[model samples]
Target: MRNRILILLATIAIYSCQDKQKTEQDNIIKTIAEDTLSKTVAGTADVSDASPTEDKAVELIRKQLNVLLKKDLPAMTKEDRFFYYEAFDLNNDKKNEYFVGFSNSYFCGSGGCSGYILNNDGTLINSFTVTDFPILVTTSSTEKFYDLIFETGGKFHLIKMKNGKYPSNPSVQEIWKGETPKDNAKVLDIDGKKLEKYSF
Candidate 1:
């Protein structure tokens, strides 16, 4: 009888362990699936093709920007080149506006970068050179802000200005500065504004 009781207890223990292991595995898989789904959704929502009126303008602007980068910053490798062209409702306006960003590499890499805002009619509104690696680019009423939260060699920086201010002087003081780690940087928001160092 004692032998049978011992055998039953062992079986129960084994089953309990197996159940716990399965639960853990399920949790891990669930987390991974959630993350992947989030990324896919975010990417899809952010991508926008140029409209009929802006299609030609986007191509022209892209061509011009590519030429400028190739001529001026020849050190950028082909793989490092990236262009983010999208249309969104900037400034809470009913009409969608163009948002463009040219980068040499990821936010932490070396390269020259520029951001542009275009009117809904495809006219140039404003453009500026962002001296830092911009991880995220966004716009608002009266100003467009580029968030350089994860850029390397410096902290976060925010570039902001009104439309038609292309080639405007960059105010370093207005940029958000923060102390970021060399490998892993933590992004912090202060008083609704990103705090980080700004370079011209």
Candidate 2:
């Protein structure tokens, strides 16, 4: 009888230890699951909070363009009647800023178009010009200190904000001249030296 009792006690001890181990394992899993759930909830909250500001910025840009279009159409030819806004990290602030460009029927020279940077409040920050109509605009880390390239006039024009203003020195070198080739897009240094060329 005593032997049976001893066996039963040993069995109980082993069972108790197994139950404790199972409970600990379950607790660890639960903790991991809760942490993952928390991260997901936080990520979703961040996106939801960010979406409204993004939407508002887009809406403001659209309104500004609409006003410009309505007011400037009378001054623009049919071919010169377009304006566009681009978003980029012009100052490397990590927040996107605006570059507004417009075609002016009034400008007669090769650089007939103008551009401006817009503040977050939709106000014009500075006025700048390009050598021609901009077919495209992009950013690169190679030229501009912040790695921004304003592709216009058959070349990439490095633009940056200096002294709380856009670079106003009109004495900068004209990187490219003549006409853009149909097959190759060329880049040049500020001294008019060729850098690289690639097919569009």
Candidate 3:
């Protein structure tokens, strides 16, 4: 009778451990699913062909770009100057917007780039000039907009788009860059390492 009771207690212990393991597995799976869903919802561009309205807007945008580039425009085709092109629903309006990157004529050297977010109508929403390439952040903010990340001069920087516009500042010309000139708290590396200053 004593031996039987011991065996029963061991079985209960094994069952308890198995249940705890299952619960942990479920939690991990749930977390992964949530993260993936968020990325997919924000990252999906779903663009096949431009509609008539988008076509017209694109042409007008090209023309405006030519005007901006002026003499240099003749040399740089859309494919040449435009480095990145993507369409995503950024503003949560259920309509996709354009995220474009152009080789910056203004900021040059080893690492210089420009970013733009255009409305569906091809109107200029916001523009940014960074040291390196601007990457799309695959998540929307709780404040109800998307983010763009830049790694310039080895320092990680962020630009937030609230209704397709960056904050109006001439110095940094980006949102959420850093609080003070000497502040290093905001910067991060690709490997999530903290850095001393901005570098390529």
Candidate 4:
């Protein structure tokens, strides 16, 4: 009878140990699963939060700009950064123009950022030194030519196309109706002071 009692106690001890081991294994798996879930949620949130601002405009021009310029994304996005706000028909013509901004200190001097206008069909249009993007583009009534208006050093530089290029010596239109700010404007509200047809 004592031997049988000893055998029963030993069986109980082994069963208890096995049960504890099983419980431990289950807890480890649960812990791992919970940790993985939290990490996944955090990663998704990070991308979702940042994409709207930083990624939206860059993404629109990234692939196409790289292909057009014959460069990779990394090279294009270096310290000399390029960005665009919108593409619009500035001249009331059917063709749209994309206004590009350049940064990294060298591009913009006291006049704010340099602007480039590219046609939607990927043609290089006229560019001007703009306090604001596209400061103002004067288009011919028939849409045959373009005139880019920009301010530089408190002066307006009216750039017209000459031989398909904005000549190094663009006609200077000193159309400052009021005191021209020595620096670039923070927004796109460009002044049309001396830009009337009566002037040179």
Candidate 5:
């Protein structure tokens, strides 16, 4: 009778450990599923052609934007919280760079609105004080970063990387006299109605 009781106790211990392991496995799978879903939802862009790397870049950029907006404009209304972003490989590197545009009045002016260029890791590469949509990515590059062309005051300006950064203000950049390149990719050209609201 004593030996039987000991065997029963051992069996109960084994079952308890198995149940605990199953619970842990389920929790891990649940966490992974939720994380993937959140990233997918957060990274959904208006343009459906985004690649996997681009989607990851968008998710990182969104997190950075959320932090900035929360810190700078804590009182931002729903309209003020809208932003547009596009991820493109500026160089031949596999990593993609991000272009984010803001329509909030605080970030805009009579000339144009503010735009930002961010590295794949969500570091600020550059910021434009007065810039407009349809930003052109030229076939040519400088400092390993592609040159950008954008219009302001009815003239197209070519922005090049100088001193390890693009010009902070596009209004003062040199005007592009050459014809627009057929292969240039347009960034942040989407309609404002499609802008994604801040996740924060």
Candidate 6:
């Protein structure tokens, strides 16, 4: 009788130990699974939070601008520099002309940011200082080129091609006394979506 009782107690102890060991293993696995799930959720959020992917044309333009402004942009970091651009056919030649705005301390001033109008082949048509973005193209044409307009210092300024080139300075340009064009489209608003990061 005594031997049987001892055997029964030993069996119970063994079973209890096995059960505890299995529970611990299960808990470890559950903990690992939970941690992995949390990390995956965080990773997904990171991807969604980033800016929208840019198109191929914009990417190619960035590379071109990098080459065009190589000397002035080599020292600037990716965060401190930006460029805003818009394309339109100013010459009525069916080829689009690009308007590239420089958003950095080196190029900007109290008047406004500096910008450029480039031909379809990335050649500089004109460079401007102290001007606003989204350079409005008027419905009226001058010398077969679209008249450009922008606002600065609470006044609108008109830019017409003179001697085959637009005005290089906006701060001193004559302010437009006429009404703003109703058919113009605002090209580059200064929001996060339109500003492209400057890269070397």
Identify the leading candidate in terms of TM-score: 5
Q: What's the count of clashing pairs in each model shown?
A: 7, 2, 5, 0, 0, 0
lDDT of 4 by residue, 5-72 (tens): 99999999999999999999999999988887887888532223434533443454554455545643
Residue 56, model 4: lDDT of 46
In terms of TM-score, which candidate is stronger, 2 or 3? 3
Model 1 deviation from the true structure expressed as Cα RMSD, one decimal place: 14.6
Model 5 residue runs over 4 Å out of place are: 1-55, 67-71, 192-200
Residue range 1-200, candidate 6, lDDT tens digits: 99999999999999999999999999999998888788788863222232332354456567777776778776777654666677678887988777777766777778887877878777778888777665677887778888878777667888888888898876567788878876786656566345544433
Model 6 ranges with Cα > 4 A deviation: 1-56, 192-200
lDDT leader: 5
lDDT of 1 at 89: 54
Better model by TM-score: candidate 4 vs candidate 5? 5
Q: How would you encode candidate 5's per-residue C-alpha lDDT over 5-109 as one tens digit per residue?
A: 999999999999999999999999999888878878897535357678656766787788876666666667666766788778998799878888886697777
lDDT of 1 by residue, 96-154 (tens): 66655544343222434556556666566666553443334332223443322323234
TM-score of 5: 0.67
TM-score of each candidate structure, all chains considered together: 0.38, 0.40, 0.46, 0.44, 0.67, 0.64
Model 6, CA-based lDDT = 0.73
What is the model-wide C-alpha lDDT for candidate 5?
0.80
* Deviation of model 3 at 73, angstroms: 4.0
Better of 1 and 6 by TM-score: 6
lDDT of each model, Cα atoms only? 0.50, 0.52, 0.55, 0.52, 0.80, 0.73
